[model samples]
Target: MDNAPNRTLLDLQALEDILQQGAVRTLFQPIYDISKQSILGFEALSRGISGTSLEFPERLFCIASEQGKLSELELLCREKAIARFVEQDLPGKLFINVSPNTLLDPSHPKGETLHLVEKYGLSANRVVIEVTEQDKVDDGFLLLKTIEHYRQLGFSIAIDDLGAGYSGLKQWSELRPDFVKVDRYFIDYCDQSIVKKEFLKSIIELAKVTKTSVIAEGIERLEELTLLEKLGIVHAQGFLLAKPARQPPRALEASQVTQLNLRSQSNHNEMSMSVGCLAQIEDAIGQSTRCKDAHKRFEQNKSLMSLAVINAKQQPVGLLHRDQLTEVFAAPYGHALYAKKSVVELMDKQPLVVDENAKLDVVSQQITEQEFDIRRHIIVTRDLKYLGLAPLRDILKHITEEKIRHAQHANPLTMLPGNVAINEAIEQRLRRQNTFSLAYVDLNHFKQFNDLYGYASGDSVIKLLADVTVQVCDQSSCFVGHIGGDDFMVVFDGDDAERLCHQIINQFELQSKAFFTSEHVEAGGYWATNREGQKQFVPLLTLSIGLVRPDLESCNNSHQVAALATDAKKEAKRYRNSYLFVCNRRKPAAPIVRIKTTVHECSV
Candidate 1:
């Protein structure tokens, strides 16, 4: 039993010696940007010295803490990792694990790591200090101060293993890290677990509110990846993505991309339709017309089921039905009783009237609300003037068709027009010979967030963005379409394309910041593993919009507009922040004029 104490001392001595010699090895794991299907960065994981019982990372850290040498050991780990990171000529940020206790060690000077970065010809901007979340942070003030000091020197902070340790939310709120790595617990079975899905969604919501970004750790299944992609998480890491390696890879495996794309296509094909377009209008009859005259018209037009009875000003007053008229006239001596009476005497006063522009689904709901008074033929009007009648059967049929069309042509997630609808809408605009602007919208770093969160959460972000787009654009003058994930198209009649795009980008910037975690806002970016499994810093999500003016005479179709606007979008994305690029490709013979305007630059 006395020998046990001596053995403990020997183990402590070994740990101290290892720390002094800086014998730890660093292995990197890649974090992927799911949307781009590319690597974002790599996390540097520390391993114990070779041929030692402390060879395992968890054991090495635990033993070091037990030996009261955690501060020294962690420092050594950081130094060695940074040195190797520089030695290998890595292309991304280096995520170095840091305990709050290590930063509290007054013996270690502040900015020591910053100086080390300079020694290796690297800037502090390339280093992301991953704060361990397992430990309780008692001295919150001290922790915040230390992190703030590091921030001043350009070192981004990440809260690691969120939802696994004590004070996770507290630490996040206080420190406001650049990245919050969701613990693997919530990610497990998130695809099937409604509870876990809700929890992840809340975390992502919290991050968005704080303007921080999340990193989903330990993703292993294709189902998980598929779910996360739908949730709109852009940053992810797991064995499925890439195991920790000595060098990072540049892109996702081609096979993985192909598989994911096929799955996406399959999922898209499964979407069902809802609602439909406006019903066709039928004619109205004059209220002053005699019953005999109206009866003659109904007899002449066998298909005329009902007609709107209108007043002198062409406003509908009542509905005259052929069946009701026939029933009253068919009665014994009915012609002698009503042959000279006006059509108003027999017309139904309470008729179901709706505007011509109302959606078929909304109109159906209105009709359903009035269970007793469903007009056999609904009266349709333009500007309160009688236009036509839409039969009940036709309305029902249109709604069903609309639902089917929505499923086939609208974005499954946003329920907005997809490529098929967008193409058709653009062609119609061109066919009308109307001057309009076509804006192509894209979300920057959206892939990174989608990789970090699950698809369920990522989808909320996309939906929110869609909502904002729909809200800002006038439905009367503008048509919005979801051009697949994180990309949209808006067609605007009149010269308000620039104004509308600015509003969209501006409104999106305000709403999008809330989607990120606090830490991401503080550092102006998020940390992820690049292709070679090296940590890289990706900027927060921003919008890049490209606008092009459509010429009725010169442009052949919507494809030409998309092609021209794509050039502008590329130029807009080249800037460090959100920007708008306008291309005047109206004249076929004239040179294209690109307008580079800084309408709204999201403060990074």
Candidate 2:
């Protein structure tokens, strides 16, 4: 007889025992942002009968599902979660996970779910139904209608695991969910991937379009949080902000709220919106006087797999969560059947929806903060009918890209235009076909110096170089840009190019002393071994000015001239001292030196 103090993984039998014994529990995990180092929200997780938390939420539920106790376990978890929240009487909405198949069960309505909420003294507004996009629904319309009925009673819905399943743009456009929770996988590395950032940005954009708010989950790092906030994401829920506790957060008093080192209102305001805004969007959606946007409509739904939805006036709404339709739709193109299918047959029974006249800010907050079941798309309409669909991923992408653009244009270290923008600026100069010289400013031995000192010292070197470039360019006819790392580019013409380069070297040579050790500086910048293993002394921070004068002789295209300037800079470096090189590429071996510096003429 194994009378062991049971220490097994939360299996179905154990979960069943826990559920039957009412020993199952709910624990909250804190979500944090890596960038701002702030607390966003807590994710509610299910615990097993063993009186300990499960290793993973998905695994815990998956095992229960395998045992055929999924429905029972979900219901029990809901009840337990509600009771706990009710006991704590927390202010924020309580997120509850529900299976679409189970929630849509006709018998589901008659079940103890609603009774449990009511019994626990919880408001439907305080409860958000979580719907997964990982699975397909048998009856799309029935699913929608069921959730809609609940919405009317004040409970909200949220689309969950957006990037995990077939839940992206299509479901977003059709469901019009009040809230869109970006999948954790999307949020995990968002601080790194631009494509992911673009995808998430699109989700935010769709949210704005469909009158929904976005909640980014799985934020564990501050940089990621900072990026999300900058992208205008309304709410964040992850581990870094705060670890989940048995008790939910209590509403702070005005003073306490102000005093707390939580997310700034301006930051949150940047992310969220007001109900008034949502209400006004009604006119924007219906009055889309651009009624002939059929082409655009088709383009948006080109990816639909099932029945497509349109507005009340019979225009295509978007596609429903195309689980079955994507699988069973009768079509030659597979998704083409949706384009041909009757809106009524393929449409969700009750599409996720929101009124445009609602408070935009409140709605947005509700969206990012609330939990929802089957959070698909958010319908934007004045009178409860949808005007258009909002794809969650697109919305997130737009906002995030906007942030990325801002960050790229504005430097992170010295806060300057990066290489991309520098290239653009050069293109703009070329577009105007201006006679400008491109100056190449580089630190000679930055790596060797920084390696000997520290990264902070390296950063100091960059700042010193940046300051020198700024001072020289701003005071003259040139524009300067950091080409990245130790390289900087300046565009100018005539004697100004050589003049600016000299000014930079003169100034940087002075500033370089502070970051160096007395001995290294006293050696008068002698060559030390680098990874290249050559005697390369910290080349006195200098600029090799490349001047390209365009008259028709050299070439008409500034692109050609810019390339010539690059070659000229290479030539100038051969002199070993700060020098300027002018490219009269049309003339072979043109002027090599002037009093200021040596010039090496290169060809087109």
Candidate 3:
């Protein structure tokens, strides 16, 4: 207690020394662009000197504000950040956090940031001025004017800690910053909180309306990051991606990149049948090509309906329809009149250009909304560069074929994929030599339940099982298929197969009670006549899940996998209650006999 005052004096002196000597340590945290799977930029964070009272940024900034050196401290920090950023040759823009009060401070030096960046030979365009929203703005107009000044100087503006401050939405609307960082509170456990997920959705929708990019910060878990990606949030910043460091990672770790790609591929497989499948590599003509030359090429290729017109950057700019050109040539003295004119003069500039990865159904809807002619061709692009052309007929044909195939392969009762699709899924994984676990699920005593309770009640129980399985399996990378009757199959891509199996069994056990009567519930089962016409007490409906991790090196086809799963299911059915049988033998024995298995009984 006697040395408290002296310690305070020493801390104040340290703050003063830091401000004067500019001893701030600048660290950078990477902001990831999910779509590009690369670092979008780095947010420059300032830390106090090591082994000091203000080692963390929060205390350091608070002390600076209390000592009336906020503006000076911020300027010095920005200078250090800019110098270090340039020294390290970091990629993408540098995001520097500046408090609104600091920008509004009368003592704040105008054009000092621009001068510092210029001094370091860095472009102001590559620097993002993050307007920290923690400080209350008494004068909104002044802050807006200051932000506009930064914008005029070619500095992109961003609102930091949105939803954690007052007047955040107002600042977003008034200043219209180029980016907005969502507060970490909302990102925490977003996967488990519906309110947080909805809030994020609203923010993303509003950002789309304002044309501002949203960056989710403080993502400390992969689940949170995965949910953000699913919500179409393009940019994310968090420790899960890369923590702040003097030398931050310029690119995502290879494993993280693979996960991102796999998630993207899995999502595409689940949601979208990409239009790229229907795109044909058609020849494209340059914008400067003569109309006569285009006509000759069209005539040379008799089947060509239209030619995509591209710019020097290989981006689709327009389309030249054969019918339109033919009509012009058939006109009186039209060919002679327009012989030397460039195709750009007559090309349709508003032709629909769709990304190669666009969903087939979405593309179909776009075609319908545009009222495109059936013979018209649409330009397809990959990353904004022209890749091929997709005819309207081909898109429609593919959609029709897909609908038919889906109907044929989908089970009529639950609409889940049937055996054929399940076999194909297993075979595809086997061909890729990917290690995955296959869970074969069946209902024990299902036949007795169907007889005791009517077939209608039985169908309801089957659907209930399907719903529970799908709900649990949808949380991870797994494929759920209805293998006729009460039997189901699941192919999980990761090692969490046993956990997922338990979840499915637990959920089904809880939900299946609803299908039983009061007496049946009390007794845990009902009396039923066996197939031999003998009375017996039937146990309650329970699940038997057989989980097997197939060895890709030895598992040859889906048939062998099916045999293993079937044997494992037999082992699980030995228990009368909900149970899981994990097969220890990865490879099946000769003649596909029963293999060694471990039984895990699930408590109701």
Compared with the true structure, what per-residue lDDT tens digits does model 3 show for residues 72-156? 8999899999999889888777999999999999988898997897577665656899987777999999988998888776678
Q: Pick the candidate with the highest TM-score.
A: 3
- On lDDT, the stronger of 1 and 3 is 3
Best by lDDT: 3
Superposition-based RMSD of candidate 3 using all C-alpha atoms, in angstroms: 11.7
Which candidate, 2 or 3, has the higher TM-score? 3
Q: Tell me the tens digit of each residue's lDDT in model 1 across 151-267.
A: 765677899999999887888999988788999998887999999888888987887777677889999888887787667677898888778876766467766765654121111
TM-score of 1: 0.47
Winner of 1 and 2 under TM-score: 1
Q: Give per-residue CA lDDT, model 2, range 229-342, as digits (tens).
A: 778885777665545667644432334222332332221112222222322121221212121232234346665422324433432233345443444444466444344444
Worst 10 residues of 1 by lDDT: 262-271
Worst ten-residue run, lDDT, model 2?
280-289
Candidate 1, superposed: residue stretches over 4 Å from native: 1-293, 296-302, 307-316, 350-375, 379-389, 474-476, 587-604
Q: What value does the lDDT take at residue 417 in candidate 3?
A: 81
List residue ranges in candidate 3 displaced over 4 A: 1-22, 29-42, 51-95, 101-129, 136-157, 163-166, 176-415, 418-421, 451-459, 474-476, 531-533, 588-604
| TM-score per candidate | 0.47, 0.42, 0.59
Residue pairs of candidate 3 with colliding backbone atoms: none
